[model samples]
Target: MSSTFDVMVVGLGAAGSSALYHLSKTGKKVCGIDQFVPPHAQGSSHGQSRIIRQAYHEDPLYVPFIKRAYELWEEIEKESGKQLFLKTGGLMLGNSNAGVIKGAELSARTHDIPYTYLSNQEISTRFPAFKPDNDVVGVLEENAGILFPEDCIKTHLEVAALNGAEILKNVKVTTIHTHSDVVTVGTNQGKYLANKVIIATGPWISEFIPELNLPLTVERQVLYWFKTNEPSIRLDNLPIYIWEYAPGKMFYGFPDLGDGIKVAHHHAGEPTSPDTLNRNISPEEISSMKNVISTYFNLNVEFNYGTVCMYTNTPDERFIIDYHPQHKNMIIASPCSGHGFKFASVTGKLLSQLALDEKPELDISLFSISRFSK
Candidate 1:
């Protein structure tokens, strides 16, 4: 009916699994619970591949987190003996003065990261598969690549188990109440008690902490995989790319990894709730994407298939990695605003540190909840 743990992770998707793994390393009694078995398509961490790049176009503040994330990824890959990341390089493309280009360049320069500024002709010459306009430019970072998200989550949970963390799958947490000394996590199965709790529940977080009234929205994003057999568009010649087609509008693509060429718009998605998100991909949606992406890629390919995901977006699209304002023993982590999978590994370790009352080695002051205080 009830069990106690040092730490209880309520959502074992991206950051929660990693937190469990890291916490398990400390030999503490840690447990992770997920409503659905993770690596499943029901949530944001389920896509086949996710992009990981050092030159963060969103902001340079993310560079240090990414730098540590890469190291943690390799560390886990070796521990799990599974190839989680693939090196295919990355390209941030947009007009010469667009946010995609300027932000990427600024991060690269600020962090002293290795990057190459490519003009329109240079981009076309280097990556011939792409169709860049005369004014389109790019910032190429060799360290950019792909991460097997499902495999990463699986590996994290497996390794965490091997390290002695209890993984409770198919267990839906209904409520969390802070007692005098422990947090009571009421679940469909029963109840769980923990000295500290980490709620990385992605889109479902707002349901748990309504008092915060945190400005968060759940967006329904669709990913497309178009069937393309162009020999020029092979993985060896192509790099993971995010293009700002028109000023603020942007879409991203990956090389055909057998399934097809993966493409999706960054922030253009319908606002919806996790429980009520429409998973069906309509003909109009596919046609709309096809019409726009056709000008950039050889969209002579047919729409093989598409899948849906959710993005728990903050007002500024940054991440929240701090303690709950009311409950000091509870840490809240909502890292998805379209881009979060890549940082799962490091975020896990940070959560472990916070739960254990240890100062995080890396500065997480940027993600504090106080910023939203008015």
Candidate 2:
């Protein structure tokens, strides 16, 4: 195999695959390497479905990126000729004064996005699956929906390969050497050199560049699917819902998509390293999730099965999408803080532009690594 390329991307998950695809379109020799075959159950992108919403409660700065991401997803769907997104609408539920509710409302209003604030009675009347307390309300956005994560990743890889981007799967990158001009990436298989390198290896990022001491944490998240006794829990009626059950705690769920309703806590997971992560979901965890479901939703559901995934998180729960402070040729693009798969499409474009030494279309100043220096 040729050991030289214009760009080499480590980690063929969401961001890497998209980067490879966009980079390939630039007619540059680009290659993507992944430790495991993507669309697999191991990473943050593998669940059956992921929620995509415009009203980002985490921060309003994400609205523009997500807006462009929606467009990119549509383009990918048209190019791939596959069903990648499903518009089931979305609901953010919490007390009227809760941070999530207030933040989501703020983003919606600030962006001029179409949304409706519904009272608890209105929520019950419109969405029978929800049973929020009198103090709880919701912000409903019709454009919000679910994205098929595995399918999205697979489509990006397939399209990238079709565009002449090399994909090296099951290859773990051990060390990355950045010289004055080119960057050399060392993997278990062999070494490859590139003019630019993107490190999108998700949880394994710290393993390769410990010198940065990036303050990144890997959290072990559990996803549960439940079989509901009521048919109203199906997708046709139920929308993707996120509830801030407590002040700072959250649990989100999807409508029944044939198999079962998928539910999981956003960030409250066990801190672990990628190499030493425990993939098993304990019964106690299931019971805990069940307790939350029973309290918020009207559906009587039984646990079907659960899967474990990892979230590469930053301290403030924002993404880190800046180039290495010292090595400009080495771009670091992991640690999405759990809610990043939705932005993969636009992120890929941004990373590609950055690698090509071009200006990014969106303002990514909020994701710069220098913020942590202070």
Candidate 3:
């Protein structure tokens, strides 16, 4: 039997949902599947909040793409009538010369983003919860804030379904192969074919595209939500903050959004495969975090909840977004280096264009898969 769709999306998270939504708008037949429905804790999109900032601290090349992502996220909100983003201004706090702080300042200056500089004293006066050391400085970027991650993924997938896309959840894609001009995907229930394929699987990217193993390692990360005794220091009054306690050490947290004040370390994680990653937090890890967080927020932090997420990282911490070198009809997109959530909306647009053989408005040289060739 012959089976086909205009596009077959292998993962239903942010990237796949966005691509399905955009493809559906064109009245094309797009089919999407996921091992588990997203907004579920099974994948990378379950966290309650993700930071969205205009300042491109990672690299100046990211500024434009992020700007477009912000715009598209707003557009999606307007179209869907859903509250997908919350504006909690962001602060980059650390030594002025630190890569996190300096890179943000440089990006803001390069892109002309609205920002403010603050000394340790100024930060304390404005936000009593934060008590940076005397030498620490802060870069306040007005455009930075948080995105309601779960809502964004759910809304996009719902919109995609409303526009003619078919989504199958709780189904596993076991195998995929290409022949002649079509690609065949075998799932738990059945098989389907498509002219084009998009593999946006987060940590599982390597499992499906082993040829480009490209040194993608999955790291086990933990998210902690703490309840604050002072309501004034909670979500509404406090701004999102990213702090570097010392060289090469970073932690970021969001204000209490009813649940509690959510905080997590940026990169201190044990390398593990997604399937075998341990979900439980260790006492040692909690003790270490308590020490760091107590330095900033008042010690009255209440340990409320915790969850585990996976970070698919590359050597340089950049993303891998491009077509399979050997397969013209297959596209690969796994930007899960812990900072990819914010760019998911815009990335979906670009991935859709690439699958359709159309040019994206922005340059993608910086994110090309070829960067790993060396």
lDDT against the true structure, each candidate? 0.91, 0.90, 0.85
**Model 1 lDDT per residue over 29-56, tens place:** 9999999998689989876899999999
Question: Which residue pairs come into collision in candidate 1?
Answer: none
Write one digit per residue (lDDT tens) for candidate 3, span 1-374.
Answer: 23689788999887888877777777888888899977688777777899988877788788998999999899889989998888888989898888778888889999999999999899888778887888889998877888888889888889989998889899899987877699999888889899989999998888888876577889989998877678656766678888987887889988878887889999899998877989998877777777777877754776777899998898888887788888978988887788998998888888888888889778877777888886
Query: Which 10-residue window in model 2 sums to the lowest lDDT?
Result: 228-237
Error of 2 at 324 (Å): 0.8
- Candidate 2: what lDDT? 0.90
Q: Which stretches of candidate 3 lie over 4 Å from their true place?
A: none
Q: Assess the local accuracy of residue 192 in candidate 2 as a C-alpha lDDT between 0 and 100.
A: 90
Query: In candidate 2, which residue pairs get closer than 3 Å at backbone N, Cα or C atoms, i.e. clash?
Result: none
Error of 1 at 8 (Å): 0.5
lDDT of 2 by residue, 1-374 (tens): 36679999999888999999889898999999998989788878887999999998888888999999999999999999999999999999999888889999999999998999999899999998888899999999999999999999999999999999999999989889999999988889988999999999888888777888999999999999989769778778899988997898899989888778899998889899877899988899999889888888787889999999999989988888889999999888974798999999999999999999999998888899999898
- Each candidate: RMSD: 1.0, 1.1, 1.2
TM-score of each: 0.98, 0.98, 0.97
